[model samples]
Target: MVPGFGQNKKAVELYKKAVDALGNRQMPQALDLFHQAVERDTGYTEAYVKLGQVYEFMRQPDQAFQIYQRAIGQQPDNPVTSLAYQSVSAYLLKKGNYQSAIPYIERYQQRFTPNSLQWKKVDRLLQTARFGAQAVQNPLAVRPQPLAATVQAFPSQYFPVLTADEQTLVYTVLKPEGDEDLMVSTQKGETWSPPVSISPQINTVNNEGTPTLSADGRTLVFTACQGRTGYGSCDLYISHKTGDTWSDPKNLGPTINTRSWESQPALSADGRRLYFVSDRNGGVGRRDIWCSELGDDGEWKTPYNLKSINTPFDEASPFIHANGLSLFFASEGHMGMGGYDLFVADSTSSGWSNPQNLGYPINTSDDQAALFVSANGARAYYSQEQSASDGKQRSKLYVFELPEPLRQKVRPVSYLKGMVADARTKKPLNATIELIDLATNKLVTRVQSDPQTGQYTAVLPTGGEYALYVVGPGYLFKSLSFDFTKKHEGEGLTMSVPLEPIKPTEGGAPAKETLNNIFFETGRYDLADKSRTELDRLVKFLEVNPDVKIEVSGHTDNQGGVANNLDLSKKRAQAVVDYLAKAGVAPARIKSAGYGETRPVAPNTSEENRKLNRRIEWKIL
Candidate 1:
């Protein structure tokens, strides 16, 4: 009997050893020991924690969460118990169970330091949870629902794209033992059929992901790594769906791919252009969104960097709304809660504008990728880790309803379309248009209307008031204000502005003259302060033309007295001269002069003309 007891004790000790090994991520050995330990002591808490941890490592968050809850109940006050609770809360939050996660998050916060990093993470989680809960409460919100039983129970699957009519679905799937592959399902009425593996020609030994289907579902674009012929480590490839068969995958060529990785290709609704991500040259950050337009001859134009919009971090996973005005992409460069967040910017006459963060519940500290907004702008679909109906945690696709107010303002292609025309003839004119954020007065984008067509389109970021200024040589500067703060979803607005010709007396047309190019508000002196940006532009231009001498002339409308107007204009011109001199432009190369109402460019017929009368010009003499 003594010998038998000793053998039982040794078995228990071996079981305990196995459980500890499992906790440390010793998978095979832990598996052997867990089997032995459970046989010896069926109720060991440490053994359960270890077992749950292994399952969690295997991407089974539900099992891990359940075991963690059990361990917490067994030892509610332990620090490890709090950790277990945090794990479950994080998993649930990722699963979009904002309400379900609240209790765990609140409990963790109540027991931990609010200022600690851990607490801060919990705070962000709570904020998103609250937002999600509110989203569910609003009747106007278009809550997104998963298509019934259409998704397969694969180890991992994400990045869903639909055909133009929303009748077909294609996505990426990763099996437990196989490489990631593209899979497609057809929509028969309301239900999507089980996904069928794509053609074997496209699924090589390498990895492929983030598939984008064309409107007709005839073209497919995706990312592939370590391919036979690619410009980078991972490059984008396209395959055509031809009558019940897929053609061999073909590389997008050097025009779209570079020495650096390029992936996540999204085609415009018209299929005339391709938007994708790359870390090639001329990017402001690690990865930038670049586009290649398809020419009429059926060839692709060289890829160009999206300079105005991309930052120094990473920008990826672009989704061009059918409306053509909105371009949604993921970025890490812009200010956000954390990691990669979804951002959208409008396309205007200028290029793309500064992007706006999608905010809160739709975006969290964790990585958010591949967003698709419905045509109505009411609902958005994205890939996220979620809890299954069977209570297992896995990376799955989710859809959420955007707030009504947000949806109204996020148009698929609602844009401010207009031509910078000659005010007198209504003839299109090439000019520079600057979109400035009213809140920060920061220049968001600088666009040049077509010299041939005088037409331009710019991207308008969501929210905020913007000041749009159109400037060009020989034309009176035009200013327009856009109040997107109140813009409704799906509403596209158009504004056609006419620019008046600058009168001869306003400084007279001098070849290569630097037009006052200075921007300011009326009745203000001290340079209007914000005049530095244009001044800097002038400084750079002057630096490039060392032999050029410019006269900075300031003029005013008839509203102000001649003396005051003259003095203000002179001071303003002197301010520009002063700035250039300070910026190393030779002081002798610059001169200042002022002409009040005597140089009015427009007839003093109305307030609008009077506003135009007050101006500035630079003459190269």
Candidate 2:
């Protein structure tokens, strides 16, 4: 046995007796002997360590922690004082005593080489302590209120997700049978209805949880463990909502799942991009966030690691907002309050920005995950556990208003809800609807209207103008535009698109309709850059129907001189013809016409009427 400095023979005898008692599992006897040995020789580090270990084994961390502290005070100059400091620092850090742990870690750091592994480990612990201490001093003004009782009927519920409209909610519940299942509820006025099993096909005897939905609430991606068809310990499965019934779930296939672990999926508003947690090979950590894009051919491509947001520690519970810019997730690696803390990162033109902690009270020593933010960025929802009066732990959903300062950091979003129908028959048609950013000429989102109901929804993030297109087979595509560059109340818009059929008119001539998205400078024939999105759609239409010939015409509202109007209209019509020719349209199949102020569709008595009269129209020949 090593000598205890100060060398008391009686103390050494007591320490040996205590070790034998501990070996025989006589915890109380060991505790009494250790206390006697430490009292005889206050400089006995071995006696103190044994006594602290007994307390820790009994799950009395406070007592164990105090024992370590006393040992350090009794032998501040002893050779083994570093061990006492290290032990005390670990207990303090675990208890969130950051300020007290810092000095201990600094002292312990001095016991090793400058660049040694032990020193580096202690240095990281010191940094974590300092970061957590600062975070406690500055906390977000957040007051989380429990969700409506009807939605919290289950004893335990978590991982809540809402549709873009906030009318539908879905979450996971832990059943008493030791398995998880999905539950859903719909909003009725200010309160939510009682939740029910999402679908018979979704919940199995095994487990199904951690669900995410598309903005329209039509697509579901969730995790299932120990499934017969699973590619991993847990794999993501997809389902589609057709009318009121959900289709059967299908595995996402090998590109997204492996023989490792995968769960907690977050999908883009259009269901084109998928973010999920996986422990597959080549990950930055034991578990990391991976992303995959859905190709146009309707297949999920191979996933790639999100290195910018992932760290050498575990990360999980990713939630990508409808705006597609702000991403909220939980990470154990980032400087946070103990376990898993929530964070938000923004995707910019220069890639992802450094993640910002969501701040205290919003986060705590306990693990926090699965945070859901509203489309407007004004409200947030999450799950938290609280001790009830009965001394049982219960988890429930919560909601809080995100402060305006943080609101501005996230891009707000609004959704467009509508239906697509044939103009003549008024019958629902399954059509492809796309929202394209006019400024950048990029497709923002694409969705398909339900075949039976003709209903569709698309998310429109604030900033810039967009061109909305609805295209279906054997039908003339509908074109519309919206400008949201300025701030406005984040309310949804409703539109019903009526598509005309591709057929000859009764008079053996093609029908004429105005193209509302085409733009030009005042009195100038040069097309604005925003006009390309519309012109490109026109090019695609002509390319698909190669045998058809069309006439492009421009009209004026009689605001300028009739002679000038006629000349300006002729030049504008020629400009459309030139663009079509450049896009590979047969020049012989196109013609330009100028019908100036003479043929005004609306009376030019008001600005709105004049706006309607100045348009570009197309007629099939």
Candidate 3:
């Protein structure tokens, strides 16, 4: 007979009927029958265990715990009845009910011999219970400071995602109409502006929540349910921002979503991997953190269980840091102070390492999730419920500096934000901005500017040189570089770009712009190999417009003698002209000139200004 089987015929019949209902997924009926079976025969252990199983399946741990307590009260020494000891211990420990759990766990461990199931759980539960008691006794000194009205005013905000600069914030809020929506706000100095929904195309009649942004803030991934396009009760969805508007949300498709539930997506900064929560099959738990990488075809690959990071319980609220190596999540499966303690795991070549509990103050007996660490790794943000002076509980969003011990292994980053506009009219222009790794000559990411605001933002992991290039159709491309080897304090760097319209070949006015991509040696006028990409672009532009003629000019800073500078500048300009000619541009279509330290865009008082004064320009003729 099975552990809970009974001798009473009527009770056994009722238990069998309930099991049938459970098998058919009729939850409410099964729950009622199980309760009836136990009430009809107080000794129906099978009925009680089945009732607990149903409660567990429904994620009602407290109800299951109470039922198990009754089972143990009747026959504490029966291995079947003794299940209450372990079940109650697990349920209590999940909420950091340590003192109450310690007695039950100790009793459970006593019933089994060395190395048995009870013996194995003894260590893990005992450790967590002891720690939970100690943590409750002494809390961490760090307290969370609430966010301003800009992000947390009235509507109630949570699930926050931010750019590396910490200036832009996106979060989920329950609208007055009862639907959940994602809202955004930007900071001005210490204060943040009121939040506004990104676009109606994204927020729909159904709910959308738990939004994550890519490093460049161009791609957004979130969760949606119940509005026609979904593979599960809730499935992950994605949207792309172009100019000032967001495209309609598209389901991430079957590979990422199953008949099982999925939600709370956390996208990687590199835009290659995704982390989220699911009750999908083959997990170590009822709910687990899972990840999928972007495939070669631009679709998400099959999700891989975050093996070491998940346990045989629920794991939620995953946040993958922009540096690409660390992950933070909340779990009830692992040993912790209490319900859903925030934990972090470091990524390795094999997979994620075993999670480490964030410990005491950062985690409390109460549940904590939705953790976000700033790019600099100096500050952290999360939401928690606190009782007001009026004795009612309210959820608040808070930020605080990281304590020293918690800051290890996190590398700071830089946020590069800017605007792209027309050179003459100064109107916002939709443009593509590309970030290139100077050392590797690889394109890191490409982002678009807002059509209404001419704005863009990108997060950069510090310790490298990057070239920022902006391009648009029928406009001269712009390029600039940032050196972030040394860390900068405050928020991050910002810049603005203006693209000059390419002049018509037979125009009334000539269109001229300095070629910022051209590079030459310190003294020699020979072009660097890296200058080929830009030269190739020039060749293509001329090829597309066959009748367009252009003039190339070179200028130098005031460091050298005027005569020598002029001589060197002329050679550099001529070298570019020669490259264009060899690359198939007709010689008749182009001319070269040198204006040594003469036409200055900025004063030569600083090194940056001096660098700006030295350039090569192409003017339409």
Candidate 4:
């Protein structure tokens, strides 16, 4: 008995040593010690957790999940058991097994507080599971059928690039076994002829995989990883086509490339911005999408991280839609259905919002690399290995139509260019404009008119009715609605809006109608239903006038009594003030006030007039 006890104590010490080694990322030593610990005590919970974590880091999720389950079975009430359960649930969710993960996620949520971060994560997981299950049950809820389809696959297969017109096809094809080069094929009549190899200056003995043609087909960017002068194993190179002949390929330079790999370059339609993937330092993850602007000197600006969309995983193969708002890329980090799914995000003034997975069918477990959308935004082109009509199997090109709802939001240009002016004088007025979505009454983006020219341009996402609010220091807040729902094809829009200044009363008192009134609710201290539309208008107004500032004040009717009305009005006013503050409005520009029936717009007599008498107002001052 004494000898057996000594072996057990030694095993416990070895287990502790293994855990410490794992914490320091010493994989080999940790693995050996874990084997010894498990041998001594097969049900050791800590040993299982350490083993699961190590396997997870090694990209063996299946193995990790089994080990985590073993730990869960060993100690059902242990806090670490929940962690193990979550890890396995996350893996299942990633594999589209949301239904199977629901029970585990539900139990985790029931055992923890909803406000805790862990519970919040579980809640999201539950929501996704419920949504996915419903989607499966009602597949019709998901859009059906591609917008269009091609009858035959391309002959010599390679990923194809669509020109701005969406007519010309440029791609790279492997030449024999020794050389790989770019090729171009134009649509002539109903059939496409055999592709012709691009100029000798552009094609080399080295391989080129993906190719991108500029809107005008004047500049071409392609991936040449094994080039002699590459900064890394893979780098993006560009060549310009001047008339018939092509210029020698030039490296994008050190500013865009690092010692780490970078490739798959996509340029905006206007040729002012370049989007590509890089494994450079300071990235949020293994690889991220980055952009470099064309500077005034016509040289590339230093690359800036697209932090809004990137997460701590690989994001690659970016395809900028002809309408610059919609960006399509592949990511392993963002919430996805499977390995490297396709996602699209819009670029707004607030930067890239959370990317949405394209969903099943268009996305699968296999890697979905490059994508090309037609100028009309109706058709999309991708490469896959499905069987074609011919007996011979090939990894050929395929084209499908995008869903109507999604197509409506795909535009060539994202930013709206226009000017705000005084309605009477037609003079430019420095004003604030806000963009609000009519469907959800949410404020989306905001911009300010140039002080010098009173000209303002704001970026607007595709789809929905947007409320435009224009306000100046002493002007009545002007409201207008823009409906981009009819923007069937991607195109740039230009317009000019007029603002009417608020005139002071005969006694020179500030106008009674201030923005504060829009935010105030009823006696309950919560937002009023009538205030919903008005608050949305205010949000849109702020978005349009990004730099404009104002204060919100609340007033009450005399019949409510002085002291009580004073406190009630103050609470109401602060409530409006809080909503705007939470919705990204700067607090310094906003202040709340309570005037207990002192600033009544009308006498408190009938209930109708009394209701109007108690109001809130906003003033630039």
Q: Which number leads on lDDT? A: 2
List lDDT for all candidates, in order: 0.71, 0.88, 0.81, 0.70
1-621 in candidate 1: lDDT tens per residue?
011223356556766677567658787787667556655765555555666677777777887888787766675665656667778777776676768888887877777676998787677667766765554454343455664465765867888886545556788888777678888878787677888887788887668888876544667888998766888888888886644678888888888887888889897654567899888877788788998987757678998888877887788899887655788998876665456778888888877777877766566647888798765475677767777788866677667777755675566323455667876567788888776766676865555666666766554544566666777776545656566677555344457767765443455454333343356766875665445555655676576667777788888887757788878888877877888898999888999898867887889889988866767677666
In model 1, which runs have C-alpha deviations exceeding 4 angstroms? 1-142, 376-378, 387-393, 412-621
Give the CA lDDT, 0 to 100, for residue 94 in model 4. Answer: 74
Q: Which pairs, if any, clash in model 2? A: none
What's the distance in Å from true for residue 2, model 2? 4.2
Q: 1 or 2: which has the higher lDDT?
A: 2
How good is model 3 by TM-score? 0.73
Positional deviation of residue 565's Cα in model 1 after best superposition, in angstroms: 64
Per-residue C-alpha lDDT of model 3 across residues 1-621, encoded as one tens digit per residue = 253544577777888889999999999999998888888898877678779888988888889998888878877777776656778888887676788888888888887697887588686777788889877777655767889866776445688888767777888887666788888888899898988886888887778889998876768999987885788899998888876678887888999999999998998875678999999999999999999988757889999998788888899989988777779999988778866788888888787787887878888677887799887788898877767687755566789887766777566666677888888778888887777776677776656677778888766667776777787777877767667767543246788888888863454466787777788988789998878767776897788878788999999999879999999889999999999999989999999999988888899999999989989988987
lDDT measured at residue 263 in model 1 versus the true structure, 0 to 100: 84
Model 4 C-alpha lDDT per residue in residues 1-621, reported as the tens digit of each score? 011233367678887788788789898788788778878888677677777888887778998898888987887677657768788878777777768878877867877887898677678678766655554443322332321224222333556687655546777665446466777776767656556777778777888768887665657888887855878878878886643667888888888777898888887754567899888888899889999977757688899899888888789889887656789998877665545778899888888867887766666445677678776576778776556587544456667777655565566334455777766567788777766666677655544566657755554555656666667765567655556776544454567876655554455654334442243334656875545666755666667767666677777787756998888888888888788888878888678888878877777878877877777777655
Candidate 2 lDDT over residue span 1-621, tens digit each: 365656689998999998999899999999999999989988788788778888877778889888887877776656566667777887777777788888888888888899799888888778878887887787778888999999988778999999998889999998767778999999999989999999998998988999999998999999998765988789999999887889999999999989999999999999899999999999899999999999999999999999999999999999999999899999999878778989999999999999998877787767887799989888999998879898777889999999766787788898998889988778998999999998889999999888888899899878889888999988778888788988554668888988877784465446556787899999999999889889888899988988778899999998999999998888999999999999999999999999888889999999989988888888777
The best candidate in terms of TM-score: 2
Better of 1 and 3 by lDDT: 3
Off by over 4 Å in 4: 1-95, 104-131, 134-159, 172-181, 385-394, 412-621
